[model samples]
Target: MTVAEIKVIAKEMGVKTSNMKKVDLIRAIQRAEGNPICFDTHSRENCGQEICMWRRDCN
Candidate 1:
């Protein structure tokens, strides 16, 4: 998906739309696609790192 589409969800939840990537966006979509609700609003706190899914590998 495009950054604009990701921005919509982030906008609804008040997350800043800068430096976000497709992998993270796709992951977020997958995480929320079927749940009744998604608490993950793309916050830096929620995402935790630029490479959230792979950060530990670097560490």
Candidate 2:
């Protein structure tokens, strides 16, 4: 997703997104949602969290 869209989601999660990179922002979002800070780390490998919302982007 674009930074703008990520920022919007971060805002809803009360995370400060100013100057945050995409991976960092995604990690923060994952933390807020009680998930692992594993955004973009899939590297095209199969991730165990099959229902992850970031699955497509992570790969």
Candidate maximizing lDDT: 2
lDDT of each: 0.49, 0.83
Error of 2 at 45 (Å): 3.2
TM-score of 1: 0.34
Give lDDT tens digits, candidate 2, residues 8-58. 999999999989998888889999998877788755365578777677678
Per-residue lDDT of candidate 1, residues 6-55 (tens digit): 66876566555567675555445445554222224435455445644323
- For model 2, what is the alpha-carbon lDDT of residue 22? 81
Cα-based lDDT at residue 28, candidate 2: 96
Candidate 1 minimal-lDDT segment of 10 residues: 34-43
Total colliding residue pairs, candidate 2: 0
List residue ranges in candidate 2 displaced over 4 A. 43-46
Among residues 3 or more apart in sequence or in different chains, the pairs in candidate 1 whose N, CA or C atoms overlap within 3 Å are: none
Q: Work out the TM-score per prediction.
A: 0.34, 0.81
